[model samples]
Target: MSRFVVTERAVINAPVEQVWEVISRTDRYAEWVDSAIEVTDHHGIATVGKTYAERNRTLGPLQTRSVWTVTEIDPMKRRVDTGVGFAPLQDVTNIFEFERTKGSDGGTRR
Candidate 1:
């Protein structure tokens, strides 16, 4: 098997606080994540050692269930989680980082 890492960055048109408010809730992923079909189980908050389960979309007309455990969190800054059940891709780690910035209009951006 091969190992690789994928990184993505986006400048959200919102403050870090606003973004964190949504992302900090593990149960809300299905609302925004395209691949997340539904949150099967979650505590409604993100905290180290907490776990959540989700039904996810895999490929064309394919789906799978995954369970994830929160590993690290930096309040309003970063979060990391490790997951299993997305077969052929073991030890999947998901990381989210937020940075506050000023938009072109001088408004908050994240």
Candidate 2:
């Protein structure tokens, strides 16, 4: 088996719910996700069993398309997706998490 891990962290200047709203919409992934090239078909809001077809840029000029299913979702907390067609990876999964940050003014930072 071959496995790899990629980690990215950022402080999005928005509230937790606001960020969740954007990430929950599978159809909008390609609009913000740098690696996603295009979404060919997105049924509806992300939910278990909901699937979407996406074209992703793996490395440089190499690209691949895959059908991803929403395997797990925790409302405004976490989301997990899994799919095949990633070649040597055979099975692949992606997880998205959101955390509320408190601002000095007693408001949510992001």
Candidate 3:
């Protein structure tokens, strides 16, 4: 087995449903992801079991293409994404977690 270390974590402020709406839209990756990352092959066919073209750079001076799919998805619990684009980052698995709670003022905290 290989050891990998993660350096950053992303926090999106939104409800699980709302977050899913944004994340599940593979066609919108180029819009939300940083410039270093790009998403392609997002045509009419959608959802898991579909291949997505990806290009990533500025990752320790390493760049590669990866084909990814929805893999595992749970509406409110989490979504797991894996890379399969024949890139150095291939086989990469990302766990996107979702949680919500009530605030002191009776408002929701995402």
Candidate 4:
């Protein structure tokens, strides 16, 4: 098997606090995540050791149910989670980091 790492960076036109407010909620994945069909189970908050489940889109017309557990968090700065059930992929880890841009207009780089 081979290992791979994917990194994506984007500047969001919102304050870091605002971005964290949305991303810190596990139940809000479906609202912003394009591949998320629905969040099946969650406590609505992100906390270490907490788990959530989601119905996600896979290949065309295919869907997979995945369970994820929050592994780490740094208040309004960063978050990490690990998941399984997407077959052909195992123990996938996702990291989300937010940084406030140095500008007169408050924005977030994530």
Candidate with the greatest TM-score versus the true structure:
4
Model 1's alpha-carbon lDDT is 0.86
Tens digits of lDDT, candidate 3, 1-110: 67585644545556556766776777777677663277757643245566677776645777777666667767666666677544444477766666664453322222
**For model 1, which pairs clash?**
none
For residues 24-77, what per-residue lDDT tens digits would candidate 4 score against the true structure? 999999999887999999988898999999999989999999999999999989
- What does candidate 3 score on TM? 0.69
**Model 2 misplacement above 4 A:** 105-110
How much is the lDDT of residue 46 in candidate 3?
Answer: 41
Weakest 10 consecutive residues, lDDT, candidate 3?
101-110
The list of candidate 1 runs beyond 4 A from truth reads 103-110
> All candidates' lDDT scores?
0.86, 0.81, 0.61, 0.92
- Residue 52, model 1, lDDT: 98
lDDT of each residue in 1-110, candidate 1, tens digit only: 77898887777777778788899999999998788999999999898999999999999889999999999999988899999999657889998877777555322333
- TM-score winner between 2 and 4, please give it: 4
Model 2: per-residue Cα lDDT over 1-110, one tens digit each: 65788777777777777788888898999989887899889976998998998888887799988789999999877889998776446678888877776664322322
TM-score of each: 0.91, 0.87, 0.69, 0.96
- Candidate structures ordered by lDDT, highest first: 4, 1, 2, 3
TM-score of 4: 0.96
